[model samples]
Target: MATAPGHPIDVHTWSTPNGWKIPVMLEECGLPYRVVPVNIGRNEQMAPDFLALSPNNKIPAIVDPDGPGGAPIAVFESGAILQYLGRKTGCLYPADERARVAVDEWLFWQVGGLGPMLGQAHHFRIYAEEKIPYAIARFTDEARRLYGVLDRRLADREHVAGDYSIADVAILTWAKYHEKQGVDLGPLPHVRRWLDGVLARPAVQRGLAAI
Candidate 1:
Protein backbone atom coordinates (compact mmCIF):
# COMPACT_ATOMS: atom_id res chain seq x y z
CA MET A 1 0.00 0.00 0.00
CA ALA A 2 1.84 3.05 -1.25
CA THR A 3 0.49 5.95 0.83
CA ALA A 4 2.33 9.04 -0.48
CA PRO A 5 5.56 11.04 -0.30
CA GLY A 6 5.19 11.41 3.45
CA HIS A 7 3.17 8.34 4.14
CA PRO A 8 3.75 7.91 7.88
CA ILE A 9 4.51 11.44 9.16
CA ASP A 10 7.10 14.24 9.40
CA VAL A 11 7.90 15.65 12.84
CA HIS A 12 9.88 18.77 13.68
CA THR A 13 11.03 18.66 17.26
CA TRP A 14 13.99 18.42 19.61
CA SER A 15 15.12 16.36 22.60
CA THR A 16 12.56 17.66 25.05
CA PRO A 17 9.32 16.50 26.56
CA ASN A 18 7.38 18.96 24.46
CA GLY A 19 9.56 17.83 21.63
CA TRP A 20 9.89 14.24 22.73
CA LYS A 21 6.20 13.52 22.48
CA ILE A 22 6.35 13.20 18.68
CA PRO A 23 9.03 10.54 18.51
CA VAL A 24 7.53 8.93 21.57
CA MET A 25 4.16 8.73 19.90
CA LEU A 26 5.66 7.59 16.64
CA GLU A 27 7.54 4.81 18.32
CA GLU A 28 4.64 3.86 20.54
CA CYS A 29 2.28 3.79 17.59
CA GLY A 30 4.90 2.01 15.47
CA LEU A 31 4.51 4.54 12.66
CA PRO A 32 7.26 5.18 10.16
CA TYR A 33 8.08 8.88 10.20
CA ARG A 34 10.92 11.28 9.57
CA VAL A 35 12.33 13.20 12.50
CA VAL A 36 13.42 16.83 12.14
CA PRO A 37 14.85 18.25 15.31
CA VAL A 38 14.10 21.95 15.47
CA ASN A 39 16.46 23.63 17.91
CA ILE A 40 14.58 26.60 19.35
CA GLY A 41 17.49 27.25 21.68
CA ARG A 42 19.54 27.99 18.54
CA ASN A 43 16.70 29.83 16.75
CA GLU A 44 16.18 26.96 14.36
CA GLN A 45 12.43 26.89 14.83
CA MET A 46 12.11 30.56 13.88
CA ALA A 47 13.57 29.89 10.46
CA PRO A 48 11.20 30.96 7.70
CA ASP A 49 10.56 27.38 6.59
CA PHE A 50 9.84 26.14 10.07
CA LEU A 51 7.86 29.27 10.94
CA ALA A 52 5.61 28.67 7.93
CA LEU A 53 4.30 25.56 9.64
CA SER A 54 4.42 26.52 13.28
CA PRO A 55 4.27 30.28 13.67
CA ASN A 56 4.42 29.89 17.40
CA ASN A 57 8.12 29.08 16.98
CA LYS A 58 7.75 25.88 18.92
CA ILE A 59 9.18 22.44 18.37
CA PRO A 60 6.95 19.33 18.05
CA ALA A 61 5.10 20.29 14.93
CA ILE A 62 4.02 17.79 12.28
CA VAL A 63 3.30 17.53 8.58
CA ASP A 64 1.16 14.52 7.90
CA PRO A 65 0.60 14.20 4.19
CA ASP A 66 -1.88 11.36 4.58
CA GLY A 67 -4.16 13.21 6.93
CA PRO A 68 -7.86 14.09 6.97
CA GLY A 69 -9.38 12.87 3.68
CA GLY A 70 -5.97 11.75 2.52
CA ALA A 71 -4.56 15.26 2.34
CA PRO A 72 -1.56 16.94 3.90
CA ILE A 73 -2.12 18.38 7.37
CA ALA A 74 0.05 20.72 9.39
CA VAL A 75 -0.59 20.68 13.10
CA PHE A 76 0.89 22.61 16.05
CA GLU A 77 0.40 22.78 19.80
CA SER A 78 1.75 19.74 21.61
CA GLY A 79 -1.62 18.80 23.04
CA ALA A 80 -3.29 19.02 19.67
CA ILE A 81 -0.46 17.06 18.09
CA LEU A 82 -0.73 14.42 20.79
CA GLN A 83 -4.44 14.04 20.23
CA TYR A 84 -3.94 13.78 16.49
CA LEU A 85 -1.26 11.15 16.79
CA GLY A 86 -3.33 9.23 19.30
CA ARG A 87 -6.22 9.16 16.88
CA LYS A 88 -4.00 8.32 13.96
CA THR A 89 -2.40 5.10 15.23
CA GLY A 90 -4.50 4.34 18.32
CA CYS A 91 -1.92 4.07 21.08
CA LEU A 92 -1.88 5.70 24.51
CA TYR A 93 -5.55 6.47 23.99
CA PRO A 94 -8.67 4.40 24.26
CA ALA A 95 -11.70 4.03 22.00
CA ASP A 96 -14.11 4.29 24.88
CA GLU A 97 -15.91 7.64 24.95
CA ARG A 98 -15.66 8.24 28.68
CA ALA A 99 -12.03 7.12 28.98
CA ARG A 100 -10.98 9.13 25.96
CA VAL A 101 -12.41 12.32 27.40
CA ALA A 102 -10.76 11.63 30.71
CA VAL A 103 -7.43 11.17 28.95
CA ASP A 104 -8.03 14.46 27.19
CA GLU A 105 -8.44 16.18 30.54
CA TRP A 106 -5.00 15.11 31.84
CA LEU A 107 -3.41 15.88 28.49
CA PHE A 108 -4.90 19.36 28.49
CA TRP A 109 -4.01 19.80 32.14
CA GLN A 110 -0.37 19.06 31.42
CA VAL A 111 -0.29 21.30 28.36
CA GLY A 112 -1.95 24.11 30.30
CA GLY A 113 -0.79 23.63 33.86
CA LEU A 114 2.30 21.42 34.30
CA GLY A 115 4.03 22.45 31.09
CA PRO A 116 3.49 26.19 31.60
CA MET A 117 4.21 26.20 35.31
CA LEU A 118 7.43 24.20 35.12
CA GLY A 119 8.50 26.31 32.18
CA GLN A 120 8.09 29.44 34.30
CA ALA A 121 10.02 27.87 37.16
CA HIS A 122 12.83 27.00 34.79
CA HIS A 123 12.79 30.48 33.33
CA PHE A 124 12.81 32.26 36.66
CA ARG A 125 15.20 29.92 38.43
CA ILE A 126 17.60 29.15 35.61
CA TYR A 127 17.13 31.64 32.78
CA ALA A 128 15.77 34.88 34.20
CA GLU A 129 18.19 37.80 33.98
CA GLU A 130 17.22 39.08 37.39
CA LYS A 131 16.39 36.44 40.01
CA ILE A 132 13.18 37.80 41.42
CA PRO A 133 12.33 35.81 44.55
CA TYR A 134 8.59 36.29 44.27
CA ALA A 135 8.42 35.21 40.65
CA ILE A 136 10.54 32.17 41.38
CA ALA A 137 8.38 31.25 44.36
CA ARG A 138 5.22 31.79 42.42
CA PHE A 139 6.12 29.41 39.56
CA THR A 140 7.87 26.84 41.70
CA ASP A 141 4.94 26.74 44.08
CA GLU A 142 2.61 26.25 41.16
CA ALA A 143 4.79 23.42 39.89
CA ARG A 144 4.62 21.70 43.25
CA ARG A 145 0.90 22.25 43.41
CA LEU A 146 0.53 20.54 40.05
CA TYR A 147 2.74 17.76 41.28
CA GLY A 148 0.47 17.45 44.29
CA VAL A 149 -2.47 17.04 41.95
CA LEU A 150 -0.68 14.23 40.16
CA ASP A 151 0.35 12.67 43.43
CA ARG A 152 -3.18 12.65 44.76
CA ARG A 153 -4.62 11.29 41.53
CA LEU A 154 -1.95 8.58 41.31
CA ALA A 155 -2.28 7.62 44.96
CA ASP A 156 -4.57 4.69 44.22
CA ARG A 157 -4.17 4.18 40.49
CA GLU A 158 -1.35 3.11 38.24
CA HIS A 159 -1.93 5.77 35.63
CA VAL A 160 -3.58 9.20 35.44
CA ALA A 161 -6.91 7.78 34.36
CA GLY A 162 -7.86 4.12 34.69
CA ASP A 163 -5.11 2.80 32.44
CA TYR A 164 -1.71 3.59 31.03
CA SER A 165 -2.42 6.13 28.32
CA ILE A 166 -1.01 9.32 26.74
CA ALA A 167 -2.31 11.18 29.77
CA ASP A 168 0.58 9.77 31.79
CA VAL A 169 3.02 10.24 28.97
CA ALA A 170 2.05 13.89 28.51
CA ILE A 171 2.85 14.83 32.09
CA LEU A 172 5.64 12.53 33.32
CA THR A 173 8.35 13.93 31.07
CA TRP A 174 8.48 17.25 32.91
CA ALA A 175 7.69 15.67 36.25
CA LYS A 176 10.78 13.50 35.85
CA TYR A 177 12.89 16.64 35.52
CA HIS A 178 11.52 18.31 38.62
CA GLU A 179 14.64 17.62 40.67
CA LYS A 180 17.01 19.01 38.05
CA GLN A 181 14.88 22.14 37.80
CA GLY A 182 14.84 22.60 41.61
CA VAL A 183 11.36 21.31 42.43
CA ASP A 184 11.36 18.76 45.23
CA LEU A 185 9.68 15.37 44.79
CA GLY A 186 9.98 14.15 48.37
CA PRO A 187 6.29 14.24 49.19
CA LEU A 188 5.04 12.74 45.93
CA PRO A 189 5.90 9.09 46.26
CA HIS A 190 3.07 7.98 44.03
CA VAL A 191 4.10 10.47 41.37
CA ARG A 192 7.67 9.29 41.64
CA ARG A 193 6.54 5.74 41.00
CA TRP A 194 4.43 6.77 38.07
CA LEU A 195 7.32 8.67 36.49
CA ASP A 196 9.62 5.72 36.92
CA GLY A 197 7.07 3.37 35.41
CA VAL A 198 6.53 5.52 32.34
CA LEU A 199 10.25 6.02 31.81
CA ALA A 200 10.73 2.27 31.88
CA ARG A 201 8.83 1.92 28.63
CA PRO A 202 11.11 1.30 25.67
CA ALA A 203 9.16 3.83 23.66
CA VAL A 204 9.66 6.49 26.30
CA GLN A 205 13.38 5.85 26.50
CA ARG A 206 13.49 6.03 22.72
CA GLY A 207 11.47 9.26 22.88
CA LEU A 208 13.85 10.90 25.35
CA ALA A 209 16.79 10.11 23.12
CA ALA A 210 18.22 12.82 20.86
CA ILE A 211 16.60 12.62 17.49
Candidate 2:
Protein backbone atom coordinates (compact mmCIF):
# COMPACT_ATOMS: atom_id res chain seq x y z
CA MET A 1 0.00 0.00 0.00
CA ALA A 2 1.13 3.54 -0.67
CA THR A 3 2.18 5.55 2.35
CA ALA A 4 0.40 8.71 3.37
CA PRO A 5 1.09 11.75 1.22
CA GLY A 6 4.54 13.24 1.86
CA HIS A 7 5.23 10.84 4.70
CA PRO A 8 7.37 7.78 4.12
CA ILE A 9 8.68 5.33 6.68
CA ASP A 10 12.32 5.94 7.52
CA VAL A 11 14.15 2.91 8.91
CA HIS A 12 17.36 3.65 10.83
CA THR A 13 19.36 0.53 11.50
CA TRP A 14 22.56 -1.48 11.28
CA SER A 15 23.06 -5.00 9.91
CA THR A 16 22.47 -6.80 13.17
CA PRO A 17 19.67 -9.25 14.06
CA ASN A 18 17.58 -6.47 15.54
CA GLY A 19 18.20 -4.27 12.51
CA TRP A 20 16.90 -6.93 10.16
CA LYS A 21 13.50 -7.13 11.83
CA ILE A 22 12.12 -3.85 10.44
CA PRO A 23 13.12 -4.54 6.86
CA VAL A 24 11.57 -7.98 7.09
CA MET A 25 8.32 -6.58 8.37
CA LEU A 26 8.24 -3.80 5.79
CA GLU A 27 8.72 -6.34 3.05
CA GLU A 28 6.13 -8.67 4.53
CA CYS A 29 3.67 -5.81 4.84
CA GLY A 30 4.46 -4.54 1.36
CA LEU A 31 5.21 -1.07 2.65
CA PRO A 32 7.54 1.40 1.01
CA TYR A 33 10.36 2.66 3.23
CA ARG A 34 13.78 4.29 3.18
CA VAL A 35 16.79 2.72 4.85
CA VAL A 36 19.26 4.84 6.85
CA PRO A 37 22.18 2.70 7.91
CA VAL A 38 23.60 3.32 11.37
CA ASN A 39 27.15 2.09 11.85
CA ILE A 40 27.15 0.95 15.46
CA GLY A 41 30.83 0.10 15.33
CA ARG A 42 31.68 3.79 14.83
CA ASN A 43 29.19 4.94 17.47
CA GLU A 44 26.82 6.43 14.90
CA GLN A 45 24.01 5.06 16.97
CA MET A 46 25.03 7.46 19.68
CA ALA A 47 24.81 10.44 17.34
CA PRO A 48 22.34 13.15 18.25
CA ASP A 49 19.95 12.45 15.38
CA PHE A 50 19.92 8.69 15.80
CA LEU A 51 19.74 9.05 19.55
CA ALA A 52 16.64 11.22 19.13
CA LEU A 53 14.98 8.36 17.33
CA SER A 54 16.36 5.64 19.60
CA PRO A 55 17.20 7.00 23.01
CA ASN A 56 18.53 3.64 24.08
CA ASN A 57 21.41 4.20 21.62
CA LYS A 58 20.48 1.12 19.64
CA ILE A 59 20.05 0.19 16.02
CA PRO A 60 16.68 -0.45 14.29
CA ALA A 61 14.87 2.76 15.04
CA ILE A 62 12.14 4.18 12.76
CA VAL A 63 10.38 7.39 11.88
CA ASP A 64 7.00 6.95 10.27
CA PRO A 65 5.79 10.01 8.46
CA ASP A 66 2.17 9.13 8.95
CA GLY A 67 1.54 8.00 12.47
CA PRO A 68 -1.51 7.97 14.74
CA GLY A 69 -3.78 10.89 13.76
CA GLY A 70 -1.62 11.54 10.73
CA ALA A 71 1.30 12.79 12.81
CA PRO A 72 4.80 11.46 12.25
CA ILE A 73 5.93 8.81 14.74
CA ALA A 74 9.33 7.69 15.87
CA VAL A 75 9.71 4.27 17.42
CA PHE A 76 12.71 2.44 18.86
CA GLU A 77 13.42 -1.19 19.71
CA SER A 78 12.91 -4.10 17.33
CA GLY A 79 9.98 -5.69 19.15
CA ALA A 80 8.06 -2.43 19.39
CA ILE A 81 8.77 -1.63 15.77
CA LEU A 82 7.41 -5.03 14.72
CA GLN A 83 4.29 -4.48 16.76
CA TYR A 84 3.84 -1.04 15.24
CA LEU A 85 4.19 -2.31 11.70
CA GLY A 86 1.92 -5.24 12.42
CA ARG A 87 -0.76 -3.04 13.86
CA LYS A 88 -0.42 -0.41 11.17
CA THR A 89 -0.63 -2.84 8.29
CA GLY A 90 -2.93 -5.34 9.93
CA CYS A 91 -0.88 -8.05 8.35
CA LEU A 92 1.00 -10.23 10.86
CA TYR A 93 -0.66 -8.89 13.97
CA PRO A 94 -3.95 -10.61 14.82
CA ALA A 95 -7.10 -8.58 15.34
CA ASP A 96 -8.74 -11.06 17.62
CA GLU A 97 -8.12 -10.59 21.33
CA ARG A 98 -6.93 -14.10 22.14
CA ALA A 99 -4.75 -14.36 19.05
CA ARG A 100 -3.16 -10.96 19.67
CA VAL A 101 -2.46 -11.96 23.25
CA ALA A 102 -0.76 -15.14 22.12
CA VAL A 103 1.40 -13.17 19.72
CA ASP A 104 2.32 -10.65 22.41
CA GLU A 105 3.31 -13.43 24.78
CA TRP A 106 5.94 -14.84 22.48
CA LEU A 107 7.11 -11.41 21.31
CA PHE A 108 7.76 -10.40 24.89
CA TRP A 109 9.36 -13.79 25.53
CA GLN A 110 12.06 -13.01 22.96
CA VAL A 111 12.53 -9.38 23.98
CA GLY A 112 12.87 -10.20 27.66
CA GLY A 113 14.43 -13.65 27.71
CA LEU A 114 15.72 -15.29 24.54
CA GLY A 115 17.47 -12.25 23.04
CA PRO A 116 19.24 -11.19 26.26
CA MET A 117 20.47 -14.67 27.13
CA LEU A 118 21.77 -15.35 23.65
CA GLY A 119 23.40 -11.91 23.57
CA GLN A 120 25.31 -12.70 26.75
CA ALA A 121 26.35 -16.00 25.24
CA HIS A 122 27.65 -14.16 22.18
CA HIS A 123 29.55 -11.64 24.30
CA PHE A 124 31.26 -14.31 26.35
CA ARG A 125 31.89 -16.69 23.49
CA ILE A 126 33.24 -14.20 20.98
CA TYR A 127 33.49 -10.50 21.88
CA ALA A 128 34.56 -10.38 25.48
CA GLU A 129 37.96 -8.90 26.38
CA GLU A 130 38.64 -11.85 28.69
CA LYS A 131 37.60 -15.48 28.28
CA ILE A 132 35.61 -16.45 31.33
CA PRO A 133 34.74 -20.12 31.36
CA TYR A 134 32.05 -19.70 33.98
CA ALA A 135 30.28 -16.99 32.02
CA ILE A 136 30.63 -18.88 28.75
CA ALA A 137 29.29 -22.11 30.19
CA ARG A 138 26.50 -20.37 32.01
CA PHE A 139 25.16 -18.46 29.00
CA THR A 140 25.71 -21.28 26.53
CA ASP A 141 23.70 -23.62 28.71
CA GLU A 142 20.93 -21.05 29.00
CA ALA A 143 20.91 -20.55 25.26
CA ARG A 144 20.61 -24.31 24.81
CA ARG A 145 17.74 -24.45 27.25
CA LEU A 146 15.90 -21.65 25.46
CA TYR A 147 16.37 -23.39 22.14
CA GLY A 148 14.88 -26.54 23.64
CA VAL A 149 11.86 -24.64 24.80
CA LEU A 150 11.34 -23.19 21.32
CA ASP A 151 11.87 -26.59 19.74
CA ARG A 152 9.11 -28.07 21.84
CA ARG A 153 6.87 -25.11 21.16
CA LEU A 154 7.30 -25.65 17.44
CA ALA A 155 6.69 -29.40 17.57
CA ASP A 156 3.03 -28.95 16.73
CA ARG A 157 2.98 -25.48 15.18
CA GLU A 158 4.78 -24.15 12.17
CA HIS A 159 5.19 -20.67 13.73
CA VAL A 160 6.12 -19.43 17.21
CA ALA A 161 2.72 -17.83 17.69
CA GLY A 162 -0.44 -18.64 15.77
CA ASP A 163 -0.25 -17.86 12.04
CA TYR A 164 3.27 -16.47 11.72
CA SER A 165 2.83 -13.19 13.56
CA ILE A 166 5.37 -10.56 14.60
CA ALA A 167 6.37 -12.90 17.40
CA ASP A 168 7.97 -15.25 14.89
CA VAL A 169 9.74 -12.33 13.23
CA ALA A 170 11.10 -11.22 16.59
CA ILE A 171 12.43 -14.60 17.70
CA LEU A 172 13.49 -15.88 14.28
CA THR A 173 15.79 -12.88 13.83
CA TRP A 174 17.80 -13.89 16.89
CA ALA A 175 17.38 -17.61 16.25
CA LYS A 176 19.25 -17.21 12.97
CA TYR A 177 22.45 -16.58 14.95
CA HIS A 178 22.44 -19.98 16.57
CA GLU A 179 26.06 -20.73 15.88
CA LYS A 180 27.36 -17.34 16.94
CA GLN A 181 25.39 -17.68 20.15
CA GLY A 182 26.91 -21.09 20.82
CA VAL A 183 23.64 -22.90 20.30
CA ASP A 184 23.29 -26.35 18.78
CA LEU A 185 20.19 -27.23 16.78
CA GLY A 186 21.10 -30.87 16.13
CA PRO A 187 18.59 -32.22 18.62
CA LEU A 188 16.10 -29.42 18.15
CA PRO A 189 14.46 -30.88 15.09
CA HIS A 190 11.30 -28.84 15.46
CA VAL A 191 13.21 -25.59 15.71
CA ARG A 192 15.28 -26.55 12.70
CA ARG A 193 12.17 -27.25 10.68
CA TRP A 194 10.53 -23.99 11.72
CA LEU A 195 13.67 -22.02 11.00
CA ASP A 196 13.92 -23.54 7.55
CA GLY A 197 10.33 -22.57 6.81
CA VAL A 198 10.76 -18.97 7.89
CA LEU A 199 14.06 -18.61 6.12
CA ALA A 200 12.53 -19.82 2.88
CA ARG A 201 10.18 -16.85 2.57
CA PRO A 202 11.05 -14.43 -0.22
CA ALA A 203 10.31 -11.53 2.08
CA VAL A 204 12.71 -12.95 4.64
CA GLN A 205 15.40 -13.27 1.99
CA ARG A 206 14.93 -9.66 0.95
CA GLY A 207 14.87 -8.55 4.54
CA LEU A 208 18.13 -10.30 5.35
CA ALA A 209 19.66 -8.66 2.31
CA ALA A 210 18.72 -5.25 3.72
CA ILE A 211 21.18 -5.87 6.51
Candidate 3:
Protein backbone atom coordinates (compact mmCIF):
# COMPACT_ATOMS: atom_id res chain seq x y z
CA MET A 1 0.00 0.00 0.00
CA ALA A 2 1.34 3.40 -1.00
CA THR A 3 1.59 5.81 1.91
CA ALA A 4 -0.49 8.97 1.95
CA PRO A 5 0.74 12.14 0.29
CA GLY A 6 2.74 14.96 1.86
CA HIS A 7 6.25 14.94 3.29
CA PRO A 8 7.53 11.52 4.21
CA ILE A 9 8.71 11.07 7.78
CA ASP A 10 12.42 11.83 8.06
CA VAL A 11 14.42 9.07 9.73
CA HIS A 12 17.82 10.32 10.83
CA THR A 13 19.87 7.22 11.46
CA TRP A 14 23.03 5.18 10.87
CA SER A 15 23.60 1.49 10.26
CA THR A 16 23.40 -0.01 13.73
CA PRO A 17 21.03 -1.96 15.93
CA ASN A 18 19.43 1.11 17.51
CA GLY A 19 19.41 2.89 14.17
CA TRP A 20 17.68 -0.05 12.49
CA LYS A 21 14.64 0.00 14.80
CA ILE A 22 12.91 3.15 13.52
CA PRO A 23 13.17 2.33 9.82
CA VAL A 24 12.06 -1.19 10.62
CA MET A 25 9.07 0.14 12.54
CA LEU A 26 8.20 2.57 9.74
CA GLU A 27 8.38 -0.19 7.16
CA GLU A 28 6.29 -2.55 9.27
CA CYS A 29 3.75 0.22 9.80
CA GLY A 30 3.77 0.96 6.07
CA LEU A 31 4.50 4.59 6.86
CA PRO A 32 6.17 6.72 4.22
CA TYR A 33 9.65 7.76 5.34
CA ARG A 34 13.01 8.89 4.02
CA VAL A 35 16.35 8.10 5.62
CA VAL A 36 18.76 10.90 6.48
CA PRO A 37 21.99 9.12 7.25
CA VAL A 38 23.91 10.19 10.36
CA ASN A 39 27.38 8.73 10.28
CA ILE A 40 28.27 8.40 13.95
CA GLY A 41 31.85 7.40 13.07
CA ARG A 42 32.37 10.91 11.72
CA ASN A 43 30.49 12.52 14.64
CA GLU A 44 27.74 13.69 12.28
CA GLN A 45 25.23 13.08 15.02
CA MET A 46 26.77 16.06 16.83
CA ALA A 47 25.83 18.43 14.04
CA PRO A 48 23.61 21.32 15.23
CA ASP A 49 20.74 20.22 13.01
CA PHE A 50 20.81 16.62 14.21
CA LEU A 51 21.20 17.65 17.86
CA ALA A 52 18.11 19.85 17.47
CA LEU A 53 16.11 16.73 16.63
CA SER A 54 17.78 14.39 19.15
CA PRO A 55 19.19 16.22 22.10
CA ASN A 56 20.95 13.04 23.19
CA ASN A 57 22.88 13.01 19.95
CA LYS A 58 21.77 9.52 19.15
CA ILE A 59 21.16 7.86 15.83
CA PRO A 60 17.63 6.71 14.87
CA ALA A 61 15.71 9.85 15.74
CA ILE A 62 12.81 10.95 13.53
CA VAL A 63 10.81 13.98 12.40
CA ASP A 64 7.19 13.37 11.50
CA PRO A 65 5.77 16.21 9.42
CA ASP A 66 2.30 14.80 9.98
CA GLY A 67 2.27 14.38 13.70
CA PRO A 68 -0.08 14.75 16.63
CA GLY A 69 -2.59 17.57 16.01
CA GLY A 70 -1.11 17.67 12.50
CA ALA A 71 1.92 19.51 13.80
CA PRO A 72 5.45 18.41 13.00
CA ILE A 73 7.17 16.54 15.86
CA ALA A 74 10.66 15.12 16.36
CA VAL A 75 11.14 11.94 18.37
CA PHE A 76 14.31 10.54 19.90
CA GLU A 77 15.20 7.12 21.28
CA SER A 78 14.47 3.87 19.46
CA GLY A 79 12.04 2.39 21.98
CA ALA A 80 10.02 5.59 22.18
CA ILE A 81 9.99 5.84 18.40
CA LEU A 82 8.72 2.28 18.11
CA GLN A 83 5.91 2.92 20.59
CA TYR A 84 4.97 6.13 18.84
CA LEU A 85 4.75 4.48 15.43
CA GLY A 86 2.88 1.51 16.87
CA ARG A 87 0.32 3.77 18.53
CA LYS A 88 0.04 6.05 15.54
CA THR A 89 -0.63 3.19 13.11
CA GLY A 90 -2.58 0.95 15.52
CA CYS A 91 -0.56 -2.01 14.35
CA LEU A 92 1.76 -4.24 16.44
CA TYR A 93 0.99 -2.49 19.71
CA PRO A 94 -2.21 -3.93 21.08
CA ALA A 95 -4.92 -1.61 22.36
CA ASP A 96 -5.93 -3.95 25.16
CA GLU A 97 -4.29 -2.77 28.37
CA ARG A 98 -3.21 -6.24 29.42
CA ALA A 99 -1.74 -7.19 26.06
CA ARG A 100 -0.01 -3.86 25.83
CA VAL A 101 1.52 -4.38 29.24
CA ALA A 102 3.03 -7.67 28.18
CA VAL A 103 4.50 -6.01 25.13
CA ASP A 104 5.85 -3.14 27.22
CA GLU A 105 7.52 -5.58 29.59
CA TRP A 106 9.56 -7.18 26.83
CA LEU A 107 10.13 -3.93 25.00
CA PHE A 108 11.65 -2.40 28.11
CA TRP A 109 13.57 -5.60 28.69
CA GLN A 110 15.29 -5.16 25.34
CA VAL A 111 15.84 -1.41 25.59
CA GLY A 112 16.95 -1.50 29.21
CA GLY A 113 18.60 -4.88 29.69
CA LEU A 114 19.35 -6.96 26.62
CA GLY A 115 20.62 -4.07 24.50
CA PRO A 116 22.83 -2.54 27.19
CA MET A 117 24.45 -5.68 28.51
CA LEU A 118 25.08 -6.99 25.05
CA GLY A 119 26.49 -3.63 24.03
CA GLN A 120 28.92 -3.80 26.89
CA ALA A 121 29.81 -7.27 25.79
CA HIS A 122 30.41 -6.03 22.27
CA HIS A 123 32.59 -3.19 23.51
CA PHE A 124 34.77 -5.19 25.81
CA ARG A 125 35.02 -8.27 23.67
CA ILE A 126 35.43 -6.63 20.30
CA TYR A 127 35.83 -2.86 20.28
CA ALA A 128 37.65 -2.02 23.49
CA GLU A 129 41.09 -0.46 23.07
CA GLU A 130 42.53 -2.41 26.04
CA LYS A 131 40.47 -5.43 26.78
CA ILE A 132 40.08 -6.08 30.45
CA PRO A 133 39.57 -9.75 31.16
CA TYR A 134 37.06 -9.03 33.93
CA ALA A 135 35.00 -6.66 31.80
CA ILE A 136 34.95 -9.08 28.87
CA ALA A 137 33.99 -12.06 31.06
CA ARG A 138 31.44 -10.08 33.01
CA PHE A 139 29.51 -8.80 29.96
CA THR A 140 29.88 -11.99 27.94
CA ASP A 141 28.49 -13.99 30.84
CA GLU A 142 25.66 -11.52 31.21
CA ALA A 143 25.00 -11.81 27.48
CA ARG A 144 24.77 -15.57 27.84
CA ARG A 145 22.33 -15.23 30.71
CA LEU A 146 20.15 -12.83 28.75
CA TYR A 147 20.10 -15.17 25.78
CA GLY A 148 19.07 -17.99 28.07
CA VAL A 149 16.16 -15.89 29.28
CA LEU A 150 15.09 -15.21 25.71
CA ASP A 151 15.51 -18.85 24.79
CA ARG A 152 13.14 -19.95 27.55
CA ARG A 153 10.69 -17.18 26.69
CA LEU A 154 10.44 -18.50 23.16
CA ALA A 155 10.20 -22.13 24.12
CA ASP A 156 6.43 -21.97 23.94
CA ARG A 157 5.71 -18.84 21.95
CA GLU A 158 6.97 -18.05 18.49
CA HIS A 159 7.85 -14.45 19.38
CA VAL A 160 8.61 -12.27 22.34
CA ALA A 161 5.69 -10.59 24.25
CA GLY A 162 3.32 -13.29 23.02
CA ASP A 163 3.39 -11.93 19.50
CA TYR A 164 5.70 -10.43 16.85
CA SER A 165 5.36 -6.94 18.32
CA ILE A 166 7.93 -4.16 18.56
CA ALA A 167 9.50 -6.13 21.40
CA ASP A 168 10.72 -8.68 18.86
CA VAL A 169 11.74 -5.95 16.48
CA ALA A 170 13.74 -4.22 19.19
CA ILE A 171 15.45 -7.39 20.30
CA LEU A 172 16.11 -8.88 16.88
CA THR A 173 18.54 -6.21 15.73
CA TRP A 174 20.78 -6.67 18.74
CA ALA A 175 20.28 -10.41 18.91
CA LYS A 176 21.18 -10.72 15.26
CA TYR A 177 24.77 -9.92 16.15
CA HIS A 178 25.16 -12.75 18.58
CA GLU A 179 28.59 -13.76 17.35
CA LYS A 180 30.06 -10.31 17.92
CA GLN A 181 29.03 -10.51 21.57
CA GLY A 182 31.04 -13.71 22.03
CA VAL A 183 27.92 -15.80 22.43
CA ASP A 184 26.94 -19.00 20.67
CA LEU A 185 23.40 -19.91 19.61
CA GLY A 186 23.79 -23.67 19.57
CA PRO A 187 22.72 -24.16 23.17
CA LEU A 188 19.87 -21.72 22.73
CA PRO A 189 17.80 -23.63 20.22
CA HIS A 190 14.61 -21.71 20.99
CA VAL A 191 16.25 -18.35 20.36
CA ARG A 192 17.74 -19.67 17.13
CA ARG A 193 14.29 -20.79 16.08
CA TRP A 194 12.70 -17.47 16.98
CA LEU A 195 15.47 -15.59 15.20
CA ASP A 196 14.99 -17.60 12.05
CA GLY A 197 11.25 -17.03 12.07
CA VAL A 198 11.52 -13.28 12.62
CA LEU A 199 14.26 -12.92 9.98
CA ALA A 200 12.07 -14.69 7.44
CA ARG A 201 9.42 -11.94 7.57
CA PRO A 202 9.36 -9.88 4.35
CA ALA A 203 8.86 -6.65 6.26
CA VAL A 204 11.83 -7.49 8.48
CA GLN A 205 13.95 -8.21 5.41
CA ARG A 206 13.00 -4.85 3.90
CA GLY A 207 13.52 -3.05 7.18
CA LEU A 208 16.97 -4.54 7.78
CA ALA A 209 17.90 -3.65 4.24
CA ALA A 210 16.84 -0.01 4.64
CA ILE A 211 20.41 0.94 5.52
Which residue pairs does candidate 1 place in steric collision? none
Clash counts per candidate, in order, are 0, 0, 0
The C-alpha lDDT values of all candidates are 0.83, 0.89, 0.90
Give a tens-digit lDDT track for model 3, residues 108-198: 9999999999999989998899989999999999999999999999999888887689999999999999999988999999999999888
Q: Estimate each model's TM-score.
A: 0.93, 0.96, 0.96
Ranking by TM-score: 3, 2, 1
The superposed Cα distance between candidate 2 and the true structure at residue 69, in angstroms, equals: 1.3
Top lDDT model: 3
- In candidate 3, clashing pairs total 0
The segments of candidate 3 whose C-alpha lies over 4 angstroms from its true place after superposition are: 1-6
**Model 3 global lDDT (CA atoms, 0 to 1):** 0.90
The model with the greater lDDT, 2 or 3, is 3
Candidate 2 vs candidate 3, TM-score winner: 3
Per-residue alpha-carbon lDDT of candidate 2 for residues 1-211, written as tens digits (9 for 90 to 100): 2243455688998888788988888888888788898999998998998888888998899999889999899999999899988988898999999999999999999999998999899999999999999999999999999999999999998898879889998888899999998877899999999998999998888888976
Tens-digit per-residue lDDT, 29-132, candidate 1: 77778887787779898899998999888888999988989989999988888888889768888999999999999998999888988988888999899999
By lDDT, the candidates rank as 3, 2, 1
Write down the worst ten-residue block by lDDT for model 2. Answer: 1-10
**Comparing 1 and 2 by lDDT, which wins?**
2
